[model samples]
Target: MAESSSTVGKRKCSQDRQVDEKPVPKKGRSLCSTGYGIAFTMHMCNFIVTAQCTVINITMVAMVNSTDHRFQFNDSTEGLSGDSSGGLNNARDTLPAGVPVYNWSPQIQGIIFSSLSYGFIPMLFLSGYLAGRVGTKRVVGVSLFATSLFTIFTPLVTELGLVFFIATRIAQSIVQGSVLGGQHALWEKWGPPHERSRLCSISLSGTILGTFAIILLDGMICQTLEWPFAFYILGGIGCVYCPLWFVLIYDDPISHPWISITEREYIISSLADQIHVSPCKQPLPIKAMLRSLPLWSVCVCGFTHQWLSITQIIYTPTYINSVFNINMRDNGFLSALPFLVAGVTGILGGQLADFLLTKNFRLVTVRKAATFLGNFPSSVLLVVLPYITPSYVTTMTFLILSCGLSSLCQSGIYINVLDIAPRHSSFLMGATRGFAFTAAILAPTVCGFLLNQDPELGWRNVFLLLFAINLSGLITYLIFGEAVIQDWAKERKLTRL
Candidate 1:
């Protein structure tokens, strides 16, 4: 089965009669309305328009309430009341002896939460297979509704047992995965080729922005309210966002109603060959994928990069606090700055990649240089971080700069995905992530061990070991990470035989 349902090439107009084109390609004269066209574009656009408006409204509400911390994330009267009953307000009795003085529960929970986070990768891959069977729109709609229900009910569960906590996290993880998988398939069909990168950047940037918002605002909120309210606020945002997705999003470009003929033609011409549409052919099998050496190369390189990212996400806060002797409040604020920098840099990197493409740079060269090479420098900087120990500000600035540079590689990794398997980019992306997230799962655990080694050399060794791994991955890509799918496949078959 082909991933997409419609083709971009010239199709017969739907109407029996033809007329000259107008500025916006008047709806009356649309090919969709003509007898030859499928009306896919018209239907899709109308849905997306509705969904976008809905999301805008939800954002306003979420952000508005977020600004008021009292309703968001602090300790509640109930929590305080319970604290008095449990500990009777004693200093040492309130929290467990080993735990940090400040609210350490949520920090510990964040680590546990991250473990569930990688479940989305497998869930996404599984969802992609299902989407190929059912219509993408149907799967997305059902998944979104399921996600919303789970999100809404999360606040209702007051009991904080390990089972309940893990269950909620797992459910949310699966939903997040489905959302990405469905959205990826939808974009492969609806997004114009020329606009794919920009549109994708815009859409996924939400995660980055959301992280920033949570870090910046959550601090303020948690200061005044209960930790449970933090989860409630985040869940409510998801609930609001889910409904808007249904209204605004369409599965394919041809299904959209609002796009002009000229725009449709442009989209078709740009992406027609890339988005496959064969209902007769069998879907690519897992065995066939395993035999593809190029795919394996992608998996390895992607895992390498992702492991580094996961390490940073999990341990960077610990790094800042231990290395700089920073307070929790300042750590939250400073931690956000790196992500904010990364988000900005990532968008710029995408633009730079496109610009380089215009200059006739091979996609492989551009991706390799921009992303893989960028990682090398970051690794080098990280290795040197522990060695420098004069001022806190100087050390932190370097760490931030290192992470900011590493982010440039993110766009490059996905861009290479398109280079290798344009027709099955989403499936390949799922495959890459499925393999990569295993490393993500281990990154934190390994970091914990390394950091816990000897007090003096522990953190230093952690940075050194991680840097070496990063450098080795970069070298592997330099030597063997072929970007051209056909060439890579050919070379692999020869080696195997």
Candidate 2:
């Protein structure tokens, strides 16, 4: 009556098949999964792009402050005269005593400072669209490479003519503008819902770090070698980074060859609720997006942040030199100090925001709290800074506190795009950044006009203007911003006949 061995084996195999056919429960998977490759790639991309964009500003300061007649190119000596020593002495005597020998006037200098934003504004939306259509990997990689090529040629272009120099700068800005949009598009596929704030903060903090590193190193390079080396060194770094970026990064977890199956599944499953349809199939809801009040509030907040930050970036060195009586080398390091603090605070603020969300705090509350802490205190400090006397230590302390506090917004308004429209986050970010760059374009001109009126009083007015702008943005966002996903974000269901 005992069953044959072959029959027993067959029966066991059938039972195993039945068990395999049953669906695994989704609840067993973890809610959040952080992928190391995506995070590291994003951080590196942001760091390099930002360094390329800001290095020119530092180089300009060094050029204007240089005592070398060759940098100014004011000498009329023809191709190494027979008496080289006499020619050198002649060039020195031509320079006016107690006056800087730069060829550029203040008006021309202002134009140069604002030119980058001109190209940056128009390319924002296009970058997002291209990223969605093609892939972020190609878009960002090509853009970074093009920007680097232009940066490497900056010194040569400057010698050509003012118009050519401005044109070159504008081209670089256009390419660099794509980086943010491409990053946001990449995040749509890679960033887990719960980990968005932390990832975004870590990546965006690269801007601060880039600024700090460029400013800190530019001074030494200018002093040790020459002003043009600043451009050569930074541009060379960007060129080197491009190859690594293409080799290591992919658009999404599903496509990444090296990612583990466990991590891939976790990312795909977590994103399912947010991205219902393939991004390519989902038509961008331009009408609904334009009408959204929350999106507009985000744009306003971005505008304020960019205006304040850009003004500081362009003018802070001059402000320090004028008020503290420091040389260009010293000014570079001192100016870099505030951004160093901002970069560190940005990471900490992001972690805190993610932690609060994990505790079940409402998204709106967490965002608003971070923004308030970031902008309000910084605004108050800036208002007080102008009133303080010309003590280098005291002024620097206030500047550091102001910039450092403002960094909390990296976790606040900056991360709100992902919450509001996870699928369309790249386009939303592009729109907001475009508006912000508009502010960057105007900030230098406005500061110049104010400074021309009176140095001390005009500078005070600039700080007051920033305070008002920051406070207004804070109030507007607090009233209108919402962190919840809008109904328009959902794909429409079709009824088949």
lDDT of 2 at 428: 75
**Cα lDDT computed for each candidate against the true fold:** 0.52, 0.73
The sequence of per-residue lDDT tens digits that candidate 1 reaches over residues 3-59 is 222322212111111101112111212234321121222222222222221221112
Q: Give the top-scoring candidate (TM-score).
A: 2
Worst window of 10 by summed lDDT in candidate 2:
13-22
| Stretches of model 1 off by over 4 angstroms after superposition | 1-114, 132-158, 191-195, 390-392, 453-455, 485-497
Q: Tell me how far the alpha carbon of residue 15 in candidate 1 is from the true structure, in angstroms, after superposition.
A: 27
Once fitted onto the true fold, the runs of candidate 2 whose alpha carbons sit more than 4 angstroms away are: 1-34, 65-101, 277-280
